[model samples]
Each structure stands twice: as structure tokens, then as C-alpha cells.
Target chain A: MAISVDYVVRETATNLRRNLLMTTAAILTVAVSLSLVGAALLLRQGVTRATLQWQGGVELSIFLNPDIAATQRDAIKTQLDAMPEVRRVAYVDQEAAYAEFKQMFANSPDMVESVSAKDLPPSFRVVPRQPELTEIVGQRFNKREGVKEVVYAEDMVETLINFTDFLQNVIFAVAGVLLLSAALLILNTIRMAIFARRREVAVMKLVGATNWFIRVPFMLEGMVQGLVGAAASFLMLVVSRGLIASALEGNHLIEQFVVSSADVMGTGLFILAMGALVGGAGSALAVSRFLDV
Target chain B: MTATRPAPTERDHWRRQLLLTLVAVAGGIVSLRLMALSVARERDVYLVIMADGSRVRSASYLVTLWPAAVALAAAFGVFASLVVHTYRVARFTFRSDIEPSPTGELP
Candidate 1:
């Protein structure tokens, strides 16, 4: 029998309306999972931005002994400059060190006033080729001659690395679970919807209806559900992003975290594609099993 | 009198057999490919600049997400099978003549 596009569309709409509750459940599940995935993507971008800034701030300060002669300081600098771990080194004499200390501790006027150029120790500020190699640079110079101390935020760097790693694993685990749940829910919803219309399906098969004729409407129904779910999730993601940005406003630490609109849209498109696949594929599999002709 | 069933034509039988064989072969290939991917070593490498400014390769052989990769392969295989089977069945249904027997049995 020849089938009309209008008939298929009307049938799809009727199926969705008849199984409204299951359809709504499927859509909500998809929306929830997709939103979570979107949030995870955004969080990853934020962490990446923070890490880039952290890389720029990564430096090891090698403080010179107050009594160290110019020759000794030059020798230390030469040694450091030749090391494979060191990217570049800047020498800060007592006067420059004192100026930097004053600028750094400007908030504490009493401390700045009490310290003089003669009291501040000269130092070499060392940048590493890679941010992660800062530890190696510190270790190499930590006990060297003419060096009073090596200053680097080892604990802070370790904490940031641990935090990023934890976040990555957590996001993957949670998103995986949620996506699985969403796909299963879609499968179940389609199965139930087809089950309700089994009598109609049987009649169609008896009357020599082609398999595609009987399948297209159901597949379309599932696709519509997925599309709706994707749209809802996209809206939720945008609103949540706005809320998060507002909440984090004026926070100096997060002020630099910004994701381009294109990136956000790309993630949104991916979520939508996943939704469509889960819904359409889920329904197709369901009909093939339950309404086999 | 006993009712004798008509023998299915050789040509029709052969056509059906050929389609089934094709599907089976495709399924086998997919399974073999999946196995190979699963058994593959979980190693990935990318270029990075070392502290001395020379480019070097870093490997994440142990840290790769093998489970996810296998899962992705499995999903793709299943989807491909589904599409191929559905298309074949739909085409067969469209072309073949299906008639119900007196007891409502279809052939």
C-alpha cells in the first residue's frame, strides 16, 4: 500500500499524544543527562583556562645569600642558564629585589618601610620550558652554593593538578552513567509505546503493509521526543551558564574564565546529535523486535 | 485427504539464503574487527616540548580509557547491523508476495 507523508506525520503525532507520559519521561531523562554533559564540558573549558593562567604564573625564585659575591652570583646564573630544565633566568639585584618586595607587600606599609635595599637578598627568577617541570628546576638549585632558598608553590601546584584530575574522572563517570540511563529510558519508552499499538500494528501487517510503512511513524515519534528533549536541555544549559557567570562575577580567581560562544554552540550541537541518535535508534530497535512483520 | 504444502521455489530459496549469508558474513567481519580493537594496546602518544626545548613524545599507555573505546566500537557495530538488517528486511517486504494460509499462517 502506498503511504502518504501526511499519514505518517499524523500517526506519529497520535502515537506521541497517546503515550504522553512515557514520552515526557523519555524527554526529561534525555534533558537531564544532556544538561549534565553540557555542564561537564563547560567545567572542562574553565579548568583549561585556569591552567593556562597558572602556567604563566609558574616560576621558581632562587634567593642568593646576602654575603654572596658578584662572581658567585654570576657563576650560579651561568650554571642555571646552562641547565636543561631551565628555560630562562632573570637576575634581580638587591635594589631590584627590594623594589619588587615593596610592590608585592605594598598592602603592609609597616613591613615595606622597615625593609631596605641592603636587607633584601638578590635572586634569580627561573622560568621552566614546561610548567610541570618547575619541580625539577627547584630541585636542581635548592641546595646549590650561593643560594639561600628556592621558592615555588609546590603544594599549591600539586593541589591544582589533583583537583583537575579528580574533576575529569568524576565528569566522565557521571556522564557515562547518565547517558546510559538516558538511552535505556528511551528504549523502554519506545517499547511501551509500540506495545500499546500492537493491535494496530498487527492489523497493518495482516493487510500487507510494508515494514517501513509501519516503522517510519514510530521512529519519527521517537525523533520528535528527542528533539524536544534536546531543545529543553539547550535552554537549561544556557540559563545555567548565565546564572553561574553571574554568581561568579567579581570573583578575581574566576574572572579570567571565559568560553567562546562557538565552543558552547559546538557542545550543544553534540548533545543534540546524541539525543537524536539515542531516540531514533532506540525506537527502531524496539519496533524491529516487537512489531516484526 | 492430507493437505500437501507446495515446495518453495529454488530461485526464491536461493535468494533468501544468499541474503542471510551476506548478513552472516558482515556480522562475522564486524565481530572480528571489534575483537581486534578490544585487544589493541591502550597506548596513545603526543608530541611535547621538553624542558630543554627539544620536542619529545609522551605516552599514556596505561592511562587510556580502554573501556570507553570498546564501548564505542560495540555501539557502532550494533548500529551498523541494525541499519543493514532493517534496510534488507524492508526491501524484501516491499518486493515479495506474502500470503496467509487457510489457518492464518503467512509465507
Candidate 2:
């Protein structure tokens, strides 16, 4: 007899109910694993966003000789403005520099009072067109007349980028490992479901029933588990999004760590798709062994 | 007597299908690795460069993160397609049957 749609659906439902506890365990494992994957993804996106908009950027400070002539300093400024690598330039006079020193040393009133405006050197603050070009831009005036020194925060920038890379690697690796475990759990669940009814399968084999007729129901059971798990995971993400954002946003430095709704939705779709794969493949492998074909 | 052995052609069919399915699984795994790389390089990172204690304009690479999304999605699609193919193959799978049953239906 030909297998009908209703037969497949009914059989699948029966199998799911027959092993209720196993089904629940598999789905819960899938949900938890997918949730971790989603959280890691959202965090990566948030951190990347915050770092791009961070206050620290490519800049250089060109300190001029205190006894430099006015014409020489003007010439240096003119040359800086003409360079393609320089985005903008600001001249910090001796008074502004002295004020900065006082602010920096405010905790030590004696130090603040000791350095007068005349003791502070004037400097040119330069922003580079690109972060990688910061060093190149600073090198230009290193030997130029009226320039005493060129300074840029090179180490700090490299450290931040490297840190983010390390973080992304660690998080994604954990997610990947968890996903594998979830897939294995799904496989075991399907195998047990099929094994419990191996006798029925042998009977069907004795008759004219095709393997597809017997296998469809089991596969569908797996798919159902996967889809349900995905739904639960998605719901969890939606419910906890506010708490996650609030916790992270409590810090002013990383207030931009909030992911957009679109990010959440996208990650949810990914989890759903992943769940389906693990389910479908898991059932196929489990049934294939018992079928001995 | 032992159950009848299947034709060589049937064995070859099963082997070919299994091999192809394995290839699909490999593709899925490779896509996952690519996704990790995509996430790492997905966006342009900005450095907080300072000149005389003052912040400067941020640099950007403008790299897109869409590839990460695409890679992950492709992995799922590839695995799902292979799984469905495997299920369809089950319809024509070869099987060995018993000549004697514990219920004494056959002697």
C-alpha cells in the first residue's frame, strides 16, 4: 500500500508521544546550545559596534621647539595641512598645554603650581585619515624644523584590536563545541526512538513496505524536536534581550553594546536553521543503522 | 541458507550515495569555519589614537559582516539538502530478510 500524508503525520506524532521524556531532553539540549550560540553572536556584534565608535582614534602630537621662530611654525602648519594623510590639525599653544598639565596634575597641587605657561611647550595635534596611517603621518615632521618630538599611542590601538580578536575566537569556539554536542544529543535521541520499535521495522521489512514509508515518520519526529527547540531558544533570547542590554549599558563606556532588533531576529533565524539541520541529519543517521541498508 | 546477496549495482548505488552525502557534510563543516573568520574580520575596528591627550578622527575598513551570515546560512542549507536526499534514498534501500522466525512462522 502507498503511504499517505496522514499516515506519516500520525505515525510521527505517535513516535514523539511514545518517547516523551527522550524528546523533551533532546529538545532542551538543543535549546540551551542554540541559546549560547545566539548570545555569543550578539555579543560579538555589540563589541564590534562599540569599538568602532570609541573615543580613541588615530592621532599624533607634534611638539615644537620652545625657541622656534613664528615663521617656521607657520610653515610646519602649512605643510601639515597639505598632506593627504592628515585629516585635521589643531595647534595647542603654550597656555592650553599648561592648562592640560594642571588638569593632569590636579591631585598634586604643588606640581600644578610649579609648572607655568612658559614652561609648557606648544604642539600640533594631528588626526590621520586612517588608523594604520598614524605612524606614517607622524614620521613626516620628526626631523622637520621647529619640531622637537612626534608622539602617538601605537601600543594601545594594537592591544585593543588584538583583544577583540581573542574574544571573538574564544566565544565562537565555545559555541561551535556546544553545537556539536547538541547535534550528538539529537542523534542519540532519534536512535533510541527507532531502536524501541525495531521489531515493527522488521515486520514492515518482511512485507512490501518501502524504507521511506517506515523512515519518514522517524525523521519527522526529529524535525519536530528540532523546530520546537529552536522556537524555545528564540523566545528566550527575546525575553532576556532587555536584561542583557541593561546590564551592559549600565557602564557608560560600553553603552553602545545594545544590539538592534534586526540582529536578534537574524540570529534567531540562524538558530532555527541550525536546529533543523541537526534534527534532520540526526534522524537519518540513526535510522540508517537500524535499517541495515 | 544465508539471505541472497544484492547485485553489485545496488551496492555501488549505496556507496555512491553515502560518499556524496559525506561530501555534503564536509562542505557544511568548512562553511562553519569560514563563518568564524568572517566574524573576526567582519567590521573595521577603530583605535583610540591620541595626540597630546586629545582624541582624533577614527579610521574605518568598512568590511561587511554579511558574509558571516551568509556562510552560516549556507552551512544549514547544505546539510538539510543532504539529509533530505538521504531520506529519499531510503525508499529504494536494499534489505536482507529472515528465512526463519522466532514465532515459528517459517521453518
Candidate 3:
């Protein structure tokens, strides 16, 4: 028997309205799940951006002994600069190093009085081809004759990266579980709805309704629910982002870690598409089990 | 043929079993998260560097809300599964009560 497309659409609309609460629950579940996933992505992006910025400013400092001869210092500088990883090397003399220190602590007369040109360590300020190689370059320079100490900002960089990585892993794990819960909730909701309408479905089957005719309406309803959920989740994300920005505006740490608008929009769209796919598939599976027309 | 009704004792027993399971699961999850957090707090390292370059070290770790979220998800999953299982059992019992007996017998 032939089924009318108009009838299917009307039936789907009626069912959607009749089970408004269930539909709403399904939509909200999807929205919350997607929002979590979206937030995780945004956080990962922020971490990547901050890491890049920090990497760009990384430098290696190679300190020298005051007794090192000028000719020996020149030779060491030449050797350091010749390395493939070395981008540029500037030799800082005792007087120049002292002057720079004095200028930095100009406001503190006590600090300036305690240190003189002779007391200040003259060194070679080394820039690397890659920020990550700063530590390696510093260690190599320290091992060379006439080199007293090496400071490559290794601890700070490692701490930041490890912290971000740990946070990102936690976010991913949480998001994964939330998404699984949403999927299970959606499947169960649809199953219950189908069970409630079993008699109506039996009557339709007796009337010669085809499987596709019955399934299309439920799929459409699921798609509508998913799209609405996505829209709500996106709005929530935008509001939360705004609130966080305002709260952290004056905070030095977070000022450099703001999520960009473009990333938010892109993530929102991706989540919306994902929600639709999951919802539609979940509903189809539920309907297929009981409505085997 | 008349349908057979479930005994009151059987119904009561099922409900009690479900309730116990829910409580046990919830308590177990709470205890697990608490243990993890307590262990983590003890090993945490906190360092304070003064303006004069002097450093002080104490116990601290960058604890955030992420762990709580994971614990919540696990709890939710346990609750959801319990609910689904209870519903299925109830539905089967209800269906059995309504269906005519194949032997044409009543109890």
C-alpha cells in the first residue's frame, strides 16, 4: 500500500507536540553534552596559542667568568654562533652587562649600589632557531671552557606545557563520557516513546503503512530536536565566554589566554552538525527495532 | 483465560533490591573520588619566590574543577543504567500480567 508523504509529515508534527516534555529533555541533553565538548576544544585552542607566544620569546643566556680573556671570549662566541641551531649571538661585555642591570633596577638605589660592573657576570645572549632547543643550546654552551652558568627558562616552559597537557587530557576524558551519556539517554528516550505508541504503530501497520513512511517522521523529529539543542548550546557558550572574559580581564595570566571569536563560531557549527547526526541516528535505531514494517 | 497478577512480596522484593543497588553505587563513587583527592592533596608542591629572589616551598597542586566533572559523569552513568534496568523489569512484569495465559489457567 502506498503511504502519503503529507500524512507522514503531519503525524510527525503531531507526535512532536504531544511529547513536548520528552522532546525538550532530549534536546537539552544534547545541548549540554555538546557544550562540554565545545568548551574543551576552546581550552585546547587557548593553550596552543599561549604556547606559541611563549615559544616565540624563548632565549638562552650563557654566563661567562670575569677572568676570561677577550680573545678567548671572541673564540667562544664564534663557536656558539657557528652551531646550526644558533640564530644569533651577542657578546655582552662586563661594562655593558652592568649598565643594563643598573637601568633595570634604576628605581632601587640599594640594589644598584650592591652590584658593580666587575660583579656583574658578562655573557653571550644566544637566540635559537627553535624555542624548544634553547635548553640544549644552553647546556652545550655551559660545558664549554670559560662558561660559568646557563639559564634557558627550561623549568617555566616545561611546567606550562605539562600543566596544559594534563588539563587537556582531563577535558577530553570528561567530554567523552558526557557524549556517551547523551547518546544513551537519547536512545532510551526514543525507545520509550516508541513503546508508548506501540498500539498506534500496530494499527498503522495493519493499515499497510510502509517502514520508510513511519521512520521518516521520527527522524525528522529527532533532527529538529538536535538543531534546537545546538542553537541553545551555542548561545550558552557565547554568554559564558563573555562572562569569563569580563571576570579575567584584569588578570595577567588569563589575559593572554582568551578564546578567539572565530574559533567559537567554528566549534559551534561543528557541534551542531554532530548533534544532528547523533540524534537522527539514535532515533532511527530505536524506530527500526519496533517498527519493522 | 484470566491473567495472573504478580505477588505483592515479589514486587516488594524487587523494589528493595533496586533501592539497595542505587545506594551502594552512589556511596562507592563518592568514596573513590574522596580518596583520590585526598591522596593528590598530600603530594602537591607549592613554591613561593619572594621579590628578593628568595624561594619558599610548600605543598600545593593546581587542582581544578575538571576532576569533579569526571566523577559526576561516572555517577550519572551508574544511575542511568540502574533506572533503565528497573524500567525494563517493570515493563516485562506489566506485560506478563496483561497477556492471556497460554495454558488457559489463572492464579
Candidate 4:
């Protein structure tokens, strides 16, 4: 019932070499599927992060008129703070507003240079208990004497939420389809490999070799194919990330949307594990058809 | 030869075929369920209370789609595994009698 390491390795190598075309095809398909899945996962993470950032940024900005006195601004802030619907209120003076604007448009030096500190208005940023209830806060100061305009980023948040949800659905559906096809391809390739070695398998069985002893080599072969494919795809993903980062150079806003390394590595590991499972299970099932206990 | 392997009986053949048939039927049911879920309309929404006591409306698409997808995947996996195992076992048993023994004792 005991098998040697060299024997197992030699058998696995022989099987792979004997059916080189099938092995290559299976590897390539697995690589393609896993890479797509990895990309989709990264994209999903990026969108989720962006959506959360957008949600956290959801607030109402009540811009004050240039002529509004400091005392009036303080009074408005106090009123906003007194409301139960308002979770918190922060007063941003004209100077701070100018600074934020400059930072946001740092990529566009010409635009940032053209905007003067006096051009930006001081405002109160209100965070509501519920983001969807931001309108209640917006209307509170809409027609006030010193208030110039009341605006909430709710529209942007809503649009981003819808887009993110759509993207998530597309990612999941497409990934699912690709992974399933990859599984089937692996299954077919294993079946072919087992068919070619049927006689050898039967001989082993007749010699009283354990079923596991007969099956382990085939499983190892599949695992090697899967690992090679996963590694290839993961390399491609890393290269693509570099390409994207270079493409987005100089655009700070878009640069912020880059997928994190943690996400990339996590997704890579997940795909690698999945590849192994697909390969091992596929070969096991294929060989099991010809084996009996 | 000192030993003779037991020959497969007619009942064993029928039983193996029946098992494979059942696997196929189960696969069909899984496929049907997947299709139904895919075409299912987006409804069955409910309100969820957040940690802050705020209520949020959740659509079926948001809440149920992932689980449905997972269920479909599980079904596909189980069906596929069962089909392959049964088919492999049936092939092995059917061919065992015709294939020559390793010891070259058939003659």
C-alpha cells in the first residue's frame, strides 16, 4: 500500500509528457479562467472601496454668502447642531475651503493657480444620522438669510451605488460562468488522460495496488497543471496592475482608485487554491471511473 | 490460478445503471433550479435595521442573489461529481471482465 516518492513523480511526469497537448490546453484554460476571476475580484474590491468612500463623504454643504457675518455663521452652526437629524456639523472657513480645493485639484496646477482663496466660500458640512435623510438637513438652511446654497452629494452617492451594484453583478456572473467552464475543461482533460492510461491502471489494480496508490499520480499531475496555470495568471495580473498604475500617472483622483496590494494578493491566493481544488477533484473523479474497491 | 475474481452479476449491472440514472436526474433538477433562479424577478424585499437603529430597504437582488449563486454552484458541483463517479465506476466494472488480468493468467 506504500508508494515511493520517485515512482510517483516519474509516473506523473510520464503522464504529463505523454499527453502534452491536452495538458497544455487544460493549463491555458485554467490560467485564463483564474486570471479573469482574479481581475474581477480586484475590480469588485475597488468598487466596494469607492462606494464606501462615497458613502462616508455623503453630507450637505451649506455655503454661506460672502457678506455673511461671523456671528451669523456661528448661530447657523449652533442651530444645525441642535437638530436631532444632524449627526455632526463642522464649520469650514473660507481659508480651509480654499486649501481643500487646492489639494483636490493639485493635479491640475493651472486650475489650482487660477482659483484664488477669496473665490471659495466658507460653509458648514453637515453629516446626517441617515445619509438618505440628508434632505431634511439641506432644507433646514436652504432659504436662510446668510446661506447662498444648500447641496448634498447624495446624487453622486446614489449614482455610484447603482453603478457599483451593477458592476458587482456582472463580475460575479461572469466569474461564475468562467470558473464553471474551466472546471468542465479540467474534467474533460483528466478523463482523456485517464483513458490513455487505462491499461496501466488496470494492471496496477490487478497487482493489488491500493486505489489511492493508483490515483495519487494522476492527482499530482492535475495539481501541477493547476499551479502552473495559477502562477502564470497571477503574474499577468501583477503586470496589468503596473500598466494601469502607469497609465493613471499624474491623475491623483484616478490614482486613488487603484486596487490595493492586499486585495491583489488575497485574490491571487484564493484563485490558486481554487485552481488546486479544481485540478485535484477533476483528476480524482476521472480516475475513479476506472477504479473499483 | 489459485484464485478467481467474482464475476459481476446481472443485478449489479442494473443497480449501477440505476445509480447513474439517478445522478443524471439530480443533475437535471439542479439545472432547472439554476434556470428558475436566473429568470426569477427581483422582489421579496425587506427592511433591515442597522446597528444605529436606522431602517434600510433591501432588495431580493441585494440579499438573495449571492446565496442563490452559491447554491447553484454547490448543486452543479455535487451533480457533476456524482455523475463522474457513477460513470467511472460503471465503466470500470463493465470493462473489468473483458480486460486481461495483470498476471497473464486468462489463457
Give residue A83's error in model 4 in angstroms. Answer: 12
Model 1 lDDT, residue A45, Cα: 68
lDDT of 4: 0.66
Q: What is the C-alpha lDDT of each candidate?
A: 0.63, 0.66, 0.64, 0.66
TM-score, candidate 2, first chain: 0.77
For candidate 4, the per-residue lDDT at A36 reads: 69
Tell me the TM-score of each prediction against the true structure: 0.55, 0.61, 0.61, 0.55
lDDT of 4 by residue, A44-115 (tens): 676576556656646777878867988898899889878998888898877887677666556668766766
DockQ of model 4, rounded to 2 decimals = 0.02
Clashing residue pairs for model 3: B44-B60
Poorest 10 consecutive residues by lDDT, candidate 3 chain A:
A153-162
lDDT of 3 by residue, A54-129 (tens): 6675677777777888887889887886899989889887788767766656666786686667776777888898
In candidate 3, which residue ranges exceed 4 Å CA deviation? A1-8, A62-72, A76-123, A128-155, A206-210, B1-107
**Candidate 1 lDDT, tens digit per residue, A1-293?**
78899999999988888888888877876776577666656655665665566556568777778788888888888888888878888998888866766665666688668667777667788888887888888887788877887777443344334544544454454445445545655665676677666767778888899888998998888888887888888888777667757876885544445555666788789888888887898788778764554
Candidates ranked by DockQ, best first?
A: 3, 2, 4, 1
* Cα-based RMSD of candidate 2: 13.4
lDDT of 2 by residue, B65-97 (tens): 444455555545544554454444343332333
